[model samples]
Target: MAQWLDAKVTKRIDWNDHLFSLRFQCADFPDYTPGQFTKVGIEQDNGVVSRPYSLVSHPQDKELEIMAVPVEDGVLSPKLHELQENDDLKVMAPATGFLVLNEVPDSDNIWLIGTGTGIGPFLSILADSEIWLRYKNVILVYAARHQNDLAYGDFIQQCQSQYASQFSYVPIVSRDKADGMLHGRIPALLQSGQIIQQAAQPLDAEQSQVMLCGNPQMIEDAMDVLKSMGLKKHLRRSPGQISQERYW
Candidate 1:
């Protein structure tokens, strides 16, 4: 059984034609970890159509935030994209996911990599100050199809400024010309060792912990590249150097 509470849309930031970020204020917000997700729904003529979205806001934030990209024919996203301030939405608690920092073991460096809306959880993780204290270095590698598709650039820049030497932000654009951003897919960057080169750090299995999120194929391809470097999937039963979450 799950509890569904009403959440009011407080703010909406449109990044591009297809991507946006939504902020919701819930009366009885569930206690959630940094990298957890909640199910959101809207009343439909036939029934309630719901989808799970990762929380982008840190636990200390007053409101919950979730980022999304509207699929052309998506059941939830199209409706979600049309949401206006003060609109009521159904939010199912308690948020759940295995992508939290506790799943990662001690390492010299932590890599947070994502594509598209998969970057949601990573944003939450970065917002929490605990990660800065826990790891020696934190790197965020965000990949999008176009330069404008990159969301939260300002926020990420703020984090880099605040963290100074300990944080790094790398943006990858696959289909557009970006003066300073990487210009290839994440898997290719990993395979070519360009990501590590850009970061000026080593990504060995023993010293690095990696988290991957987004398209399943990207995850699979990146895992293969990581495996070749001696990193294996991290599991509760068999902990390793890598963890992942797949976006539908």
Candidate 2:
């Protein structure tokens, strides 16, 4: 069983009214892969209220980071949003998840598809240098309802600067297009061929491997589209083109 360790909030980033990232420091925290998730908890009068969050921080980063949108009147999130610098919480460390790169097979192109805070793990994966060397091209397709809901602009810009040739960032906004961002949902784009046109890469089972994270509905609908396009769900028993993890 994973035991809890006390952690102190180093900082909190308010990406928008609802979305935020919390950075904390914990002593003796175990190392974790880029896409893995760990449990965060708040001690209460009855017991600890806990939830799982994928790490947005790099393995070597002194602070561990996780992003989330608070749930109104919920047990944990609203309280989490209220946390400030120096506030203490609990972490169930030694992160675990299947979204890491090692699970992915060799491919000509790697597509990272995410929606909402599902973009968190992809940020950590992009920060690591190994991903750059492993694939010919890395395409990040981030989907959000509106422009303001899309966070981490600075880091995304830094990545575009660092890996200009090998990396491609695509932002999709469904509800509004104030910044003129590509308007539509992921499943719709996958079906329309517009997304592939933007990435300038073909998504095929033989040459492409796509990793999806975020909304269950988006994942389900997108998987249906990919399957119809001949891509199979990836598994340890039988590796194939599509790999996915659902984010609450």
RMSD of each: 0.9, 0.9
Tell me the whole-model lDDT of each prediction, alpha carbons only: 0.91, 0.93
TM-score, cand. 2: 0.98
Candidate 2: tens digits of C-alpha lDDT, residues 66-178: 99889988889999999999999899967899999999998989999999999999999998987899999999999999998999999999998999998888899999875
Off by over 4 Å in 1: none
Q: Lowest summed-lDDT stretch of 10 residues in model 2?
A: 175-184
Which parts of model 2 are misplaced by more than 4 Å? none
Backbone clashes, each candidate: 0, 0
Highest-scoring model, lDDT: 2
Candidate 1 residue lDDT tens string, 1-248: 57888899999999998899999999698688999999988877886789999999998899999999888888899999999999988899889999999888989899999999999999999998779999999999999999888999889989989998999788899998788789988988998998998887779888899999998999999999999989999998998999999997
